[model samples]
Each structure stands twice: as C-alpha cells, then as structure tokens.
Target chain A: MKPLTTGIAGIALLAVLVLAPLGLPPFAMTLLTEAVILGLFAMSLDLMFGYTRLVSFGHAAAYGLGAYACGWLLLNTGMPMLFAVFAGALLTGIVGLGVGWMCTLATGVSFSMLTLAFAQLLYAISFKWTSVTGGSDGLAGIPRTVGPFGFAALSSKAGFYYFALACLVGGFLACRALVRSPFGAVLRGIRENEAKTTALGYNTRLYKIAVVAVAYGLGGLAGGLYAPFAGFANTELLFWLLSGQVLIMVIVGGAGTLVGPILGAAFFMLMEHQLSAWTEAWALYFGLIFIAFVLFAPEGIWGLATGLATGRFRPASERH
Target chain B: MSTLALLLTQTVNALSQSALLFFLGVGLTLIFGLMRIVNFAHGALYMLGAFVGYSIAAWSGSFWLALAGAPLLVGLFGAGFELTILRRLYRRDAHAFLMVTFGLALVVGEAVRLTWGSDALQVAGPPALSGVVFMLDEPFPVYRLFLVAIGVVVAVAIWQFLERARLGLLIRATSQNADMANALGVDVKMIRSCVFGIGCGLAALGGVLAAPLVTASNGMAATVIIDAFVIVIIGGMGSFLGSLIGALLIGFVQVFGNYYAPDFALAFMYLVMLAVLVMRPGGLLGKEA
Candidate 1:
C-alpha cells in the first residue's frame, strides 16, 4: 500500500476504534478490548517471525509472565495500575533477554523447539507453584487502574475498553517505528539471508537476541494490559496452544505486514466468538479453516486484500 | 522397602516410561529424517490409537486385538493423509508443513474429544500381565516389566530392520539422498508414504501400550507431543539411537526428579534440554549445525 493510503487507513481505523465504545454495547466493547490486546500480542510475534524469520513457538512465555507479574503485583502489593504494568513489562523484558540469549544460539526448527521448552518450563512452574501463582486456578481479583492520574474503577467495561484501546494504538505506533527503522532493515536482511548478513560483517546473533528481547518486551506490555482487562492470569496463557493461535493469526492475516496481524486477531476473535455460539465443535471448523489458509492463501487475508487492491498477487518470496 | 529398593523400583518405572517414549520418538525421528516434515499431529495420532484401542478392547474383550488393530488403522490414516495433503506441500516452505500438521493436531484432538467425549477412559492391561511381581523387595506391576521387555525387543528389532532388511535399505537410501535414490529407480514417493505410515504406526503403538497406564484421553496428545519433540530434539532430529538414549535420559530425570523435587520435575527435564542445546546445539547425536 502507498504511504498516503496507509496513513488514511490508519486514521480511519483510529477513528473507528475511538468511537466504537460510544456506539457499541458492553459485550462487543469487551470483545474489542480483548481483540486489541491479542492484536498487540500477535504483532510482537510478527516482529520475530515475519521480520526476523525467527519462529518462536514459546512467545507466550514472556506474555504469560507479564500477565502473572502484573496480576501478582496488583493482588499482593496494591500498587498503582500503571506501575504494575511497567513492573510486569520490565520483569518480562529481563526474562526475555535471558531466554532469548540462549535461544538465539540455534536456528530453524531447533530454535523453535528450544523456545517451546523454556515456555513449558515456565508453565510448569506456574502450574505447580500454587502458593505464589495461584496454581491452576490462576491469580484473580486484579484491580483495573488506568493512566498516571490513578483513576480507579476503570473496571467498568467501557472505561477499560478505552484504556486498552489507547495502549494498543500506542503499541502499534511504536512497533511501526521499530520495523521501519534501520535496525528493522538489518532484521529483514537477517531474515532474507543470515549467512549473507554475517558475511557482510554484521553480528547476526546479537541482532537476533536484541530483536527477540524487544519483541518479548512488547508482548509483555500486551500481557500487562491483559491481566487488568481479564481480572486474572491463567497458566493457559503460557501454553503452546496460545502461541499457535497467535501464529495462525499472523499467517492468516499476512506475516510481513504490520497491520495484518491486528486484522487477523480481530478476525479470529470474532470468528471464534461467533462459531462457539453456533457449535461446541468450533475447534474442528477452525482447524479446517487454518489448514485451508495455509494451503491456499499462505500470505493471508492482508495479502489477499493487497493483491486485489493492487491487481497483482505477490508470492511469499516477494512479500515483506 | 529400603531406600535402595525404592530407588531401584523407580529406576524400573523409568525404564518402562522410557520405552513408551522411545516408541513415539523413534517414529518421529524417522519421519523427520525422510520427509523433513515435523509431524505435530503425531501426538494426535497416538491419542487416536488409544481411543481406537479402548473401543476395540471394550467391545471385543480382547486386549491383544486392540494392540494389533489400533496402530494398523492409524497407520493407514497416516498414509492416506500423506498421499492427500502432505504430497502437495513438499515444494512449499518448510513452515507450511509445521502449520498444516499443527492444524491436523487440532482437528484430530477435537475429533477425539467429540467421539470419546471429554471424559477419560480406562483400559486395563491384559489379564495375564496384570499381576505384580516382587523385585528388589518391592512389588512392581508385571505389566510395567512387560513394557520394558517390549521396548527392548522393539528397539533391537528396529535396529536390525534398518541395518539388515532390503526395504529398510531402500528407506535409508532415500532418506540419505532422495534424488540419487530416485535416479536409481527407487520410488521415493512410495518410500516417503511408507515411512510416514510406519512413523505414525509407531506413535500409535506407543499410545496403545500407554493407554492401560495413562488412560485414553484428549489431554494425552498435548503432553506426549511435547515430550516426544523434546526426545527427538535431544537425541538428534533424525538419529534413531539418539532418540532411544534421549528417551532414557528424559525418563530417568522425570522419575527421579519427581521423587526428589516434585515441584521442579518438569523444569528439570527442560533444564537438561537447555544444557544439551547449549553444549550441543544439534543435540547429542544430531549433525553439527
């Protein structure tokens, strides 16, 4: 898409999101809030998978850690909400740095598997350490606080929705800036040809670890928003299944495009909500759709839309 | 029992667990070796096998029939899936295979839940093997010993088959150099399908054996797939013997870790994997990256 058109679309999307809560019912508002949070989560995965070509099957480890940290802080310390979110993101960023360092040592499927193993370790801890993490029941009764002004009682559906929307927009802009920067160019270079990047005198490993940490920190920020929105953090968030879900969103929306995952997340969340309402066997249908998407439209919905708009279909090789 | 006896019993328990894991890991490695596709649905196939085994045993009152029937059925399904779906994907990005197989896992898991319901189903070991035997002043379940024996025999058989048999030679040749094997008139496509079927069969066989112990349930697929992947990763992705050794290592760690520190048993397993990854990124038997 051209820069002008992209800018217009961004403004239009922002307008819709800003006005959504005023017109929409409380239930739809809640769904939109969750969708935005999940969209940010999917965007973080895209930074690593789409841009860096690092398929992290354990991305949820950082995300869940963020949620758990935020939840624990709110429940135990009674800290201000913004402080809890910052603390959660900081803690997750540190953990991400450590884990991403080990993970960058390998590449390809082995790297994916290693990330998965680390996530599972974290999941095990959360599930077993009942005293601190609330075990399988998860940490509950988290209060929702918004902004530096210390606005409590943002637990109302519309209030939380707007807060989440603000965070999502902020996150999207930050991610867009990061991806368009020179560092993102290096990441793209590494993705296209890591060996070539290394031969070009670039330290690809250091770049990969740095990008991973940044992606994970963003994931943590999303998770921080998630804890207050949901009022609890569960171990399921750390499971590989959640990682797979985000991956599906990235692939189904459009991997390389920044806006694609958000579209994908919104599509998936809405479809899931609608499907489950229609049938209990929603996963079966969802699986079929996922398989069809991978087979037929590997570039995803965003790719399809762009192809239609531009009168040309770019193959996966030529995509961003 | 003395502490020594308890430790011995746990060691025996670990052996049986390792045997079960070997069944899943070896098959996974074989498929990956030949096809270069990580079969995420292998766990779902295992779950299907357990469900099939449960039904067969429940209806016919014959544990032996279920043991033979389940793997055979799932193996055929695996071959069909390869012919229908995976055959078209070989030319695409490797990530496509992972996504499709993961989708298959979701479909299969959901299908299992729909068919069997969400409740766990129990299937007893065969009557003859249900008894207990004293070992090291501890009464160990005879079925577990039988599982260990089966594991050893199967490991030896697999080794012998891969080393000595003509078809096995064809499989090895194809995996080693598919283009060369094709140039030499070997039907590489047929070999790929066959290997995939065998791999799925091996996973199913593990499920059938494990059903009596772990019970047949939808949750089994999730846990077993991760463990199977860990074994394959630690053993070397495509190395058969590496899978066996990796399984044994994981099995011992899990059993001993559970005994000593239940809270950290799973974490300990992952720690070992990380250590191996740091020391040998390709795994113990994996080729250098």
Candidate 2:
C-alpha cells in the first residue's frame, strides 16, 4: 500500500513537470528543458553507480560522444532527428562498452581513476580534433527537426520543451522497468556483494560492463536531445568536473530509489541557480553544503525521508 | 651546434621539471598510500602555499622567511581541514571521499579567487638564486638547480624517514593492514592525521619552491593535480621511490611530447598510463601482491 501511494505521488509529480512548459514563460521553459535533460542524465548515472556499485567518473565522455554523434550526423548526413538521436546513443554505447571493459578489470579507486583518465583522454581529443568537434567553439546551428511522434513543430521553445519532456518521461519509465526486471535484481545482488554473486556462478564482470553500457547509452540519449535543443555541443561536456556534478546529484538525491534522481537533479540545479545568484563565492558555500551532507545526511534526502518513515536510520541491508 | 644546445637545454629543463613533479607527486602518493584518501585539494593547498609565500616575501622583502613560513601556515590549514571535515569521511568509501575532497578543491579555488581577484601573479626568485647557470655551455635558470637540489634532499629525507624511523614503520604497517596495526596498538588514527598533515605540508613546500618558476593562478591547481595524479598512478599509488621514477619519466614524456606535438602532451600521458596498466596492473613500482 505504501509503495502504491508513492507510485501515485511520483506520477503526479511527473505530470506537473510535463505540464510546466504549457504555462511557464519562454525563459522558464528553457530552464525546464535543461532540468529534464539533466534529470535523465542523473538517473542514468544512478542506475550503474547506485545499483551496480561501479563508481564511474567518465560518464561525461559518453554524453559528449553522443552529442557529437548527433551533431555530426545532422550536419554531415542531414539525418532525421529521430534517427540521429538513436544513432548517437548507439555510438556512445559502443564507446561505453570499450571503456567499461577496461574499467571492470579494476575496482575501488583504480576503477574510478581509470574511468577519469579515459574521459580526460577523450576530452583532450575533442579539444584537439577541431575538424570534428569544432575545436572548443563547439558545433553550432544544429537543426531542430520535427518530433518523432509527428508533432506539428518542435523548433519553438515550447515545442522543444515538450520534446525534452517526452524524452525524459520515456527514459525514466524505461529505467524504472529495467530496475524492476530480473537483470536489475542481479545488479542489486552484485552491488550488495560481488564476491557472493561471483560465487553463485553469475558473471559479475559482464553484468557490470553491460549495465554500464546501458547507462552510458541513456546518458548519450540525453546529450543527443540536448544538442538540437541548445543548438551546440561543446568539449566542456567531456570534462571530469561534469562527471563529478552528476555524482553529486546522485548522492545528493538518494541513490537506488527510482524517483530519487529526479528530485536530486531538480534540487542540484535549483541550488546552483539560487547560490550563484546570491554571491560570487557560491562555490565555497556549495562545498560547505556538500561537506555538511557527507557528514550529516550521507543517505541523502530520499534516504533520510525513508529512514524517518520506517524508523530505521541505519538499515543493515542498505549500508554504503 | 645550436640544435645541440637546444637539446641540452631541453634535457636540463626536463630535469628541473622532474624535480618539481617529484615534489608534488611524492606528497600525493604518501597521502593516497597511507590514508586511503585521494586528497583532491592537494593542488589547491599547493597554490595556497605559493600565495602565502609570495605575500610574506613581498611584505618583508625576505625570500628566506617566506620559504619556511609558507609551508607551516599551509600545513596548519591542511591539519584543520583534516580535523574538521575530512576525519568524518574516513570510514566512507573512496568515491565519497573523492567527491568531498573535490568539493573542497572547488571551495579552495573560489576562495583563492576571491582573495586574489583572479589575477595571475609571479614571484621573484631570491637574489642569490637569480640569473642563469651554465649547463654544458647552455644557460639554465639557477633557481632551477636550487629546486632540483631541494627536491633531491627532500626525497632522501623522506626515504630515510620511511625506512629508519619508528613512525614510518607504523605508517607502512597501517597502510598495508589497518586492522593488524590497530590491534598492535599503533594508534592508527593519529598516524593517519599526522601523515596527512605531513603530506599536505610537503605539497606546500613544493609550492613554495615552485612559485618563482610558475605563475600563481587559481586555475592551475586542477590542472596540476591531474598531472600529479598521472605521475602518482604511474609510479605506484603508495611508493615514494615509485613517485620519483615516475615523475622523471613523466617529465621527459611531457618535454618530448611538447616538442613533438604540443597539443597532445596530456593525452600522451594518459596513453602511457593505459600502457602501464595493461602491461602491469600494479603500476611501475607497485607490489604484485
């Protein structure tokens, strides 16, 4: 009964998010679009880090790769938006698979560092490879094509907002379904205890690689959507700092819970907006808040709420 | 030949660069090895040391006092951070600690920017160390030689301390097996805090020495830390000797790479790290066990 109520509440919140563009001003709609895309990106990261216990610090690589793929396809091949988005995500998945193979060989800090190193390499390539990536100026003038559902137009702010909303909803639903499946159970098992899962004859490494690929692919989809809407894809997306931001969002919102990432993404974006507006030294304040969270609410907002409701702040099964 | 002189100059430059790299890399390696924390704010602390040194020297017109006082001040700040924020994160996973420290780096960078107003500043070398020294008929900065000497002496001192001192043995034991060391009444927590302070102080000392060579900027910390991490990883995470060798190798690689393709030097370093991992997962000087 509690789960059902939570599910209904989630749907209500998502409905509000989807309808927000209808009534909000143009600038507000644009912010909504960014929030939706970042929310999807955050959700993709949590799928692997939260469920699989693989701390990846190179997701920006996949995101950048996807954006470039879509931008490249649109400019060179004049492909449709629908085909371009999926194609971009496919290319990102391939790259993710390759990087994940290398990452799965190591664990703990080495694994995190390897992913960061690989991403850094990609960032360097993107910056140097001017012919393809626009050499830091980024690819501009990305054509906004009609939506796949045959909507009348999507070049307008409201149209694109709706388009972004659809993508976020689709991605969020797909993620929820994926986690509820048998594969997700195995991933959870692997997260809880890799040794026991390996002992049970499950190929833990392969599962990790596969899930990472999926998560990266989804993240790439978000990036691909972002390119047409924002009309540019820069090398900055490949930076490790962007990856760090995603991790912050995941941990800040509460990992493992399906709705947690959405809340986390909204909160992170909103906090940045408010803090930066208030002072030039917001980064310092941001750091202080993050430190406070690490010390006090390490379980994050959703974790804290669930803990309070259940009257168990320290669940043995949910030990980080 | 002029080409010969240039080649010799590059080699001399590489040696000095290696010293600078070693000074920072060794401190990072010690922290990572001893405390199991990545210390992402290390570069920021280094920057602070440089700024502190420059301020003191500029005010008092005494480079010598700045050399000694900068590191002490930065070390106290590092110690305070460890006690106030970092200690609580000791039991958290490395990823959490990494995020926390990364946040700390951001905080420190912004604070530096607020204090310095984002302007780049250069520190002047002391009069005695100013001017050029002849290295096989090629002129090299004399301060560069001083940096190398300092690096060598510090490396030797650290090597001796880790090998001969009682605290060093405890650190080694704690790093290898924290539980066993705790069981043996080694005061593991105190050792970790002290090691962190020392590690941070070493980074500050490097910054003090490096201030005259490199311009102080808020943005340099992140870039320097990335380079330092590459060197540390290549040298083996916790090995002091590994850091020295790795820094020299990386220094040469950077010099040669910049000569060949200036744009790809950083990428070339990553490729080298990948190659090392493939050939030997334990890193160059890392233990196989």
Candidate 3:
C-alpha cells in the first residue's frame, strides 16, 4: 500500500474504533473490548511467527502469567491498576526472556514442542496450586480502578472499552514501528535465512531472544488488560487452547500485517459469539471454517483483501 | 500394603502405563519419521478408538471383539483422512499440515462429544482378564499384565517389521529420503498413507486397551496428546528405540511421581523433558540436530 493510503486507512480505522462504543450495544461493546485484548495477544504472536519465523505453541504462558500477576497485585497488594498491568508486563518479559533463551536453542518443530512443554508446565502449576491461583475456578473479583491520572473508572463498560482501545492502538503502533525498524529488518533476515543472517555477522539468537521478550511482554500486557476487562482471570486464559486460538487469529487475519490480526480477532470473536448463539455444535462449523481457511485462504482474510485491492497476485513472500 | 508390595505394584503399574505410552508414541514417531508431519489428531484417534471399542463391546458383548475391531475402524478413518485431506497439504508449509491435523482433531473431538454425550463410558475387561493376579503379596489386575504383554509384543513386532520386512524397508527409505525413495521406484505416497494408518491404528489400540482402565472419556485426548508429545520429545522424534525408552522413562516418572508427589507429578514429568532437552536438544535417542 502507498504511504498516503496506509496513513489515511489507519486514521479512519482509529476513528471508527474510538467512536464504535457510541453506536454499539452494551454486549457488543463488551465483545469489542475482549476482541481488542485478544487482538493484542495475537499481534504479539505475530511478532515471532509472522516476522521472526518462530512458531510458539505456548504463547499463552506469557499471557496467563501477565493476567495472574496483575490479578494477584490487584487482589492482594492494593496496587494501582495501570501499575499492576505494567508490573505484569515486566514479569512476563523476564519470564519470556528465560523461555526464549531455552526455546531458541532448538528451531522449527522442536522449538514449538519445547514451548508447549513449558506452557503445559505453567498450566499445571496454575491448575494445581489452587491456594494461590484459585485452581480451576480462577482469580475472580479483581477490582477495576480509575485509569491513569483518575481519568475514568475502568469498572464501567464504556470506560474499559476506551481504555482497552487505547492500549490496543498504542500496542499496535509500537509493534508496527518495531517491525519497520532496522532491528526488525534483521529479524526478517533471520526468518528468511538464519544461517545466512548469522554469516552476515548478525547475532540472530540475540535478535530472536529480544523479539521474543518484547512479544511476550506485550502478550502479558494484553492479559493484564483482559483480567479486569472480564472481571477475572481464569485457568482457561492460560490454557494452550488460547494459544491456538490466537494463532488462528494471526493466520486467519494475515500474518506479517499489523492490522490483519486485529481484524482477525474481531472476526473470530464475533463469529464465535454469533455461531454459539445459533447452535450448540458451533465447534463443528468453526472447525470446518478453520480447515477451509488453512486449505484455501492460507494467506488469510486480509491477504485476500489486499490481493483483490492490488489487482495483482503477490505471493506471500513479495507482500512481506 | 507393605512398602515392598507397594513398590512392586507401582512397577507393574508403570509397565502398563509404559505400554499405553508406547502405543501412542510409536505411531507419532513413525508418521514423523516418514512424513515429517506431526499428527496432532493422534490423540483424537485414540479417543475415537475407545469410543468405538465401547460401542462394539456394547453391541457384541465381547471385549475381545471390540479390541480387534476398534483400531481397525479408526485406522481406516485415518487412512481416509490422509488420502482426502492431508495429501493435499504435503506441498505447503509444514505448519499447514500441523494446523490441518489440529483442525481434524477439533472436528473429531466435537463429533465424539456429540455422539457420546460427553460422558465417560465404561468398558469392562473380558471376564477372563478381569481376574486379579498376586505378585509378591500384592494383587494386580490381570488386565494390566495383559496390556504390558501386548505392549512388549507390539514393540517387538514393530521392531522386526522395521528391520526385516520389505514394507518396513520401504517406509524407512521413504522417511530417510522421500525424493530418493521415489527415484528408486518406491511408492512414497502410498507408503505415507499406510504409515499414517498404521500410526493411527497403534494409537487406537492403545486407547482400546486403556478404556478398560480409565473408561472412554472426552477428556482423554487432551491429557494423552501432551503425554504422547512428551514421550516423542524425550525419546527423540522419529526414532523407534528413542520412543520405547522415552515411554518407559515417562511411565516410571509418572507412576513414581504420583506415588511420591501427586500434585507435582505432571510438573516433574515436564522438568525431566526440559532437563533432557537441555542435555541433548534432539532428545535421548533422537538424531543430532
């Protein structure tokens, strides 16, 4: 896309998102907030997956950790809301660094499996350590506080929606800028050819670890937001299924594109809501759609849109 | 039970658990060895097998017949899946295959849930195998011993097939180098389908054998798939011997961990996997990365 066109599109979308709550029903607003939080999580996965060329099967670990951390701080210590979220991100980043260090030792499938193992381990801890994590019941009754500078009480639906929207937009811009920087160029190089990048005198492992930490930190931030957004943090938030769901969002939205995952998250959440309301066997239909997407629309919904807009067939590589 | 008796009982339990793990792990490794595709639906197939076993036993009133029939039916379904869907994905990114199989798992799991009402279905062992056997003053279910024996026999049979059989040679060749095998006039596609079927069959067999112990349940796939993946990782991906040793190690760890620290058993198992990867990233018997 042209720079002018992209800029206009971004601003227009931002306007729509900012003003969406005024027109939307209360339930829709709630869904939008949840979608935005999840979109942020998906974007974090995209940092590693779409750009860094890593497939983490355990991305939920960072997300869940952030949520639990934020919930714990709010429930136990009486910390401010924003500070607790920040603390959650910081803790998640550190954990991500450690996990990234170990996971980056293996590439491809092994790396994915290793991440899965670590995530499952965390899940087990959360599920079994009921005294601390509230077990399967999850950490509930997290007190929502006023936004920074006492701007708005996030306990209110519209207030929380706008706060989540702000976070989503800020997070998206930051990720977009990061991916456009020289460091991101190096990360892409590693993705395309790790050995070649290494031979070119780049420290690929360091780049990978750095990217993983950033992505996971962002994922944690999303989780922290999610806890108060939904009024609780459950073990399900940390489950591998969430990781898979976010992955599907990334793939279905369009990997390597910032706007795509957000759209994908919205599409998925809306579809899920609509489908479940229609039928109890919504999973069967969801599975079919997922399979169709994998088979036919491998580039995802955004990819299809871009392809149609450009009037040309740009394979996945050239688009990047 | 005395300490010695308890220890002996746990050992037997570990062996039986090892047998089930081997069933799940070997199939996973075989398909990975040949196709380099991780069949995420293996657990779903296992669950399907148990459900099938339950149905057949309910109809025929013969646990033996269910044992023989369930794996075969599931294996056919797997083969059909491979030919219809998976074959189309072989040329795409490896992740494509993983995602598709994951989708398959979702479909199968939901289908089973809808069909079986999401409740755990019981399948009793055959009357003959329902009896108890005494070992060192500890009474153990004969069914468990049967599982252990079947596991050992299956392991040996697979070992021999891979070593001495022509079909196994073809499978090994294809796994080692599909292009080279194709050039040598071996039917790579056919071999892959067959391997996939066999792998799914093995998992089903494990499920059928395990149903008597754990009952047929929807939740089985989630737990079993993770354990299967751990076993494959520990044994080293794509190595039969690695899978055997990995299964045994995990079985012992789980059994002993449950005995010692029930709360931390799963965590302990993962810790061991992490330690193995730290020491040898390829797994215990996996090929060097």
Candidate 4:
C-alpha cells in the first residue's frame, strides 16, 4: 500500500516537472532540461554510492564518455539515434568495467582516487584527441536523428526537453525495480558489512561490478542524450567537478531513497539559477548551504520531510 | 647538448618540479591519512598561498617577505577550516566530505577571481634566486636550485617531525590505527586538526613557490590538485617518503613526456597511476597493500 502511494506520488511529481517548462520561460525550460539530465546522472551515481557504499568521483568519466561516444557515432557512422545511444552505453560499460576492476582492489579513499585517476585520463584523452573528439572545442553539430517513432526534429529545446524528461522517468522506474530485486538486497548486505556478505557465499566483487556497470551505462545514456541537446560534448563533462556536483545532488536529495536524487537535482539547479543571478559568488553561498545540510540534515530532505511528518523530529536522547 | 650539462639540467629541473609536487602531494596525503577527508580544496589553498605571495611581493617589493609570510597566513586559514568545518565533517562518508571540500574549493576559487580579477598575476623570483648557475658548461636557473633546496629541507623536516616529534607520533599513531590510538590515551581529534593545518600550510607554501613557475590564475588550483592526486596515488597515500619519490617520478614523467609528446603528459600521468594501481594497489612504498 505504501509503495503504491509512493508510485502515485512519483507519477504526479513527473507530471508537474513535465508541465513546468510550458508555464516557465524558455530559459527556465533549458534549465529544466539540464536539471533532468543531471538528475538522471546523479541517480546512477547514487545507485552504486548509496546502495553499495562505493563512492566514485570519476562517474562523470562514464557520462562524458557516453556523450562523446554518441556524438562520435552520430557524426561518423550516422547510426540511428537509439543505436548510437546504445553504443555509447556499451562503451561506457567497458570503461566502467576497467575502472571498477581496479577499484575493487581498494576501499574508501583509495577507490575514490582510482576512479578519479581513470576519469582524468578520459579528460586528457578528450583534450588531446583532436582528430576524433574535436579536441577542446568538443564535437559540435551532432545531427538530430529520428526517434523510433520517426524524425520529429528534436534539435529544438522543447523536443529535447520532453525526450530528456521521458528518459529520466524511464531510467528512474528501471532503477527502482533493480533496487527492489534480490540482487539489490545482496548489494545492501555488502554495503552494511562486506566481510559478512562475503561469508554468506555471495560474490561481492561480482555484485559490485554489476552495480557499477549498470550505473555507468545509465550515466552514459544520460550523457549521450545531453550532447545532442547541447549540440556539443567537451572534456569538461568528464571532470571531477561534475562528479562533485552529482554527489552534492545525491546528498542534498537523500541517498538510498529513490526519489531523493530527482528532488536534489531540481533543488541544486534551481538554487544555482537563483543564486548566480543574485551574486557572482554563488558558489560560496552554495557551499555554506551544503555544509549546513551536511551538519543538520544528515538524513537529507526526503528523510527530514518524512521524519517531521511522522513526528519523529525530536532528539533520540530526549525521547526517553 | 653536453651529456654532463644535460643530465645536470634535467636533475635540477626534476628537483624543482619535485618541490612543487611535494608541496602539493604531501599535504594532500597527510590530510587524507589523518582526517580521512580527501580535501579537494587543498589545491585551492596552494593557489591562495601563491596569490597572497604575489600581492605581498607587489606591495612591499620584497620577494622574501612574500615567500616567508604567505604560507603562514594560508596555514592560519587552513587551521580555521579544521576548527570550524572539518571538525564536524570528520566522521562522515568520503563522498559527503568530498562534496563539502569541493564546494569549498569552488567558493575559494571564485573569491580569488573576485579579489584578483580574471587576469593572471606576474610574480618574479628574488634577485638572488633569479639568475642562472653554470652547470657542466650549461646554465641552470638558480631559482630552480633554490626550489630543490627548499624541497629537500621541507621533506627532511617533515620526516623528522613525523619520526621524532610527540605530535607527529600521535598523528602517525592515530592514522595507522585510530582505535588503538584512542586506547593509548592520545587525543586523536587534536592530532587530526593539527595534521590538517600543517598539511594545508605545506600546500600553501607550494603555491607560493609555484607562483613564478605557472600562470597565477584562479583556476590554477584545479590543475595543480589533479596533478597532486596523480603524484600522491603513485607515491602511495599516507607515506611521506612515498610522496617525495612519487613527485620526483611524476616530475620526470611530465618533463620528458612534454618533450616527447606534449599532449600525452597528462594522459601519461593517469597511465602511470593506473599501472601502479594494477601492479601495486598500495602504491610504491605503501605499507597497507
């Protein structure tokens, strides 16, 4: 019954987001598109980060790789849009496998560093591989292709916005199903106690790899879609900074909870829009807000909302 | 080029680069080791040190004042971070900490831009360290030699401090085994705060020293920190000796990589890190692996 309510709520939220671009200005719609794409990317990061206790600062490497792959395929092979996106996901999966393999050797800080190193490598490659990547200028003019239903000219902001929103919805539903499955239970077990999980005869490494691969694939899909909308793919997307942005979104929304990242992505993008408009030192303000959230809302926005509604906001010590 | 001169020049260049690398890597490694925080803002602190030095040099017309004073001021700023923010964040997950520090980096970087404007600042070396020295019939920059000397001195001082000082002992103990250190009655919290300050101070010094070497821009910290991460990874995290050796190795890679293939230098660093992780996850001298 609870899950059903949550599902209905989620659908309602999606409807609101879909309709938001229409009422708002064009600039707001553009921002909405960016938020949805980033929200999807953040959700992918949270899948591994929140569920498996594996935090990757290089997740953007996969996302950026996906963008590059899609753009590259579109220009070079002129493959179908869906097929190009599929190719991007495949490439991103391969890279994720390589990164995840190295990462499994170390836990905590070492894992983060390894992922970062791998991502930075991608950034460098993108920067230098001018012949293929268009170098620093990035691969621009990625032709808009027909969706499965046929060509509808998605090069416009409105078409891309709907496409992005649909992708976010589809991806979110898939992730929710994956989390509810037995595989996800095993992952949560591993996250709680790796030693105990391993003792239970579960191949923890395989699970970790599987989770990371899925996250990478999804992130890649988001990135690939993003490129054509932005009409470019730059090395900037592969940076640790982008990874940091995603982490903040996940944290601000809530980890381990499904709807948190979507809310987080919206909050962050909107906050940035408002803050940047008010002052150039918006980052400083954002940092302060982030610190406040980390200190006060350890459970995050969704957690806090639920806690308040349930009358569980009182201190545990005071409960006695 | 004469073999003697070329080798001498390369060695000097390596040491200079190593000094900059050590400044960036050691603080990063130490902070990570002690606080269990990645301190993504460490590079920004380094850049802040350089900008401070630049302003001081510009104002007082004394390179000496800038070199000596900027790091101290920056160190104080780092201490402020430990006392106010990082103290509460110590027990959080690495991802949260990373996000917080990353935000801090963004804020600091923007502040730098606001203060210094969007242009690069020109900072020169002291008169005494500005010229070149004849080495094997070739001239090598004296400033580079000074950098080498400073690197060696700082490295040695850190080595002795960690090995000999009571505070250092406490920090090493806390980092190696926090539970055991707590059992032994050491104030783990105090040690971590001090360690964070010292490490950030060292990064600040590195920035001040590097002001003349690289373009002093607000975004300089981002590039420096990334390179620092590569160096720290290669040297093995949490080991002082590992950081020094890693810096030297990376410096050599960068120099030679630039000569051989300029575009590959950054890629080359990542390749080294990947190779190291695959071959030795614990780093070159890391005891953990």
Write down the TM-score for model 3: 0.98
Which runs in model 3 stand beyond 4 Å of their true positions? A147-151, A316-320
The digit string of per-residue lDDT tens for model 3 on B60-94 reads 99999999999899999888989998998887777
Give the winner by DockQ: 1
* Residue A10 in candidate 1, Cα distance off native in Å: 2.8
lDDT of 2 by residue, A35-125 (tens): 8888888889998888888888778887888888998888778777877888998888888898889877777666776888898999889
Candidate 3, A1-320: lDDT as tens digits: 66787788789988998989889998888888999998899988999998988998899998999999999888898777878888998999999999999998888778888898899899989989998899989999998876467755666888778778888889988998999999989989988889999999998999999998999999999999988777798888877778778888888899888788888898899889999999887887888888998888888877887777676656554644
State each model's TM-score restricted to chain B.
0.98, 0.94, 0.98, 0.95
DockQ for model 2?
0.58
Candidate 3 residue pairs that clash:
none
Model-by-model lDDT, in order? 0.89, 0.83, 0.89, 0.83
**Positional deviation of residue B116's Cα in model 3 after best superposition, in angstroms:** 1.5
Worst 10 residues of 4 chain B by lDDT: B89-98
User: Which stretches of model 4 miss by more than 4 angstroms?
Assistant: A1-5, A147-150, A153-156, A313-320
Query: Which lDDT value does model 1 have at A22?
Result: 81
Ranking by lDDT: 1, 3, 4, 2
Tell me the TM-score of model 1: 0.97
For every candidate, how close is chain A to the native chain A in TM-score?
0.96, 0.94, 0.96, 0.93
Q: lDDT by residue for model 2 over B168-254, one digit each (tens)?
A: 989889989989999999998888778888888888887878888887777778777877888887888888898998899888889
Best-fitting candidate, scored by TM-score: 3
